[model samples]
Target chain A: MKQNLFSPITESMYYILLSLSEPLHGYGIIKKVEEMSQGRLKLAPGTLYGALTNLENNKLIISVGVDPENIRRKLYKITDSGVDLIQIEIKRLEELLRNGKKVYYD
Target chain B: MISQHKLFFAWNEDKEMDYLQKMARKGYIFHHTNFFNYYFEEKEPESINYAADFKGFDKMPEEEYLQLFEDAGWTMVCRYGAWYYFKNMDMDALLYNDYHSVQNKYKKLLLFLLIVGLPLYYQLFIFLPRMSNEALTGFLFGFRLFVYFIVILHFSATLKIFKLYLKFSKNIHE
Candidate 1:
């Protein structure tokens, strides 16, 4: 994985990483992101494709193989590095939330 | 099939998409484009969302690039040069969701124009001034004029794409 990738990734990138808890194809990832975000984040095809390529290049995600149901579609899953990045992001978010709450109560 | 001659500007390709969508609504479904003509076949009038992506078929296999769009419910209409045309029945479907990706597309286009156009312009400017009156007035002069016209077109196209790149760059923050 790139050293500076998770220095606070984009919301789309975070959602995409979270959606890959299971192996999914391009369109499946879009649906998964929408579902995870409660239909608030609908990824466009081009955006998802570009992001997938970037993630794969950075070794954050890896394509397993073609989807059996649809031969034209390829399935992708997050790497261990991806999971580690997500954990770091969650910790960072929690720290921010704790700081915000402290300010709110003061 | 009926063919209509039309000129599409690269920087404002939304106009081309709009034109294609309008034709689809008028029972003239766009088939493909050749040279400066757009060919359309008669079909039932239907509302379609047409999108134009300015990308060359060099980086990845065309099949793989197209499959992604196809899986996302887009139908590939045709590819003219560096432009890929797609259509979908859903009007809300977009090819690009974020400003960054859109800006990157324009940036790539601008870079390509500069790489290809700058050398041609430089060569033209350097060679034109040294040509003697004898060569300037000969049959080659017509060819020279054609070259000048082409260079002018190329310059304008580069200028327009550069402007679009600047506009999209500003929009990335929003």
Candidate 2:
């Protein structure tokens, strides 16, 4: 029921939605998130699983496929809506950076 | 040797886990769990990591469900019921990073209480009015006491979980 997708995106949600731009399963997303963040983002199974549920519920992501060996490891990909979220989030963060720069750099 | 201990679902879950962890440190690696007993086998006293999570069905082929964790270097130790216990093979073995997902576990527990508790409440309501005689009244009074105790326990527990969820939401990373 969180319809306002980009109102407040947490760091974990940001990475998770970004990771799903391409199809990735549960463990795949975990590994990718760590690699994507240069070992900074350490995602837990419970958090990842719950985020996945919420993301799907909000229609930001969709199940694309499943791991061949393990059917439970369903692959996920960002939807068109999710793409819009990424763009909006990027702009919002850019504004924050610009405002910080004006005070600190000036 | 196997040791028996009581288990309470709502409040004592963390304590139950800690008790097992301490036993593991003392060279008593936890073997399996029953309703009231946690069996442990002797082993060398060394640091071992353990984590637990609650998950549900559509988790077909339990081997593969576990293999995903195994691939991530978390060896599945046991799956007694909904609780899946694992031991870390490496440092990146945290089962949960944020309290939001941890809240999901309590939600499931609350659902279970509603399912089991509602019917009992209904049955007691029907039985209470019929006990008019002194002997029956005494029996009903004692039984009602037991029922009321459980109602208080469950109510307090549910409220506690809701408060925890709210607290977690405040400073939460997700």
Which prediction has the highest lDDT against the true structure? 1
List model 1 lDDT by residue over B51-126, tens digit each. 9876642354566678889988888999887788899999999999887777767776877888788767875987
What DockQ values do the models have?
0.51, 0.46
- Report the C-alpha lDDT of model 2 over B122-141, residue by residue, as the tens digit: 75576655653553456677
Tens digit per residue, CA lDDT, model 2, A46-84:
677667777887889998778887676778899999988
Tens-place lDDT digits, model 1, residues A1-106: 3344555866778888998889998889989889888999888877787778778878899888888977778888999998888888877778878999999975
Clashing pairs in 2: none
Residue A54 displacement (Å), model 2 = 1.9
Name the top DockQ candidate. 1
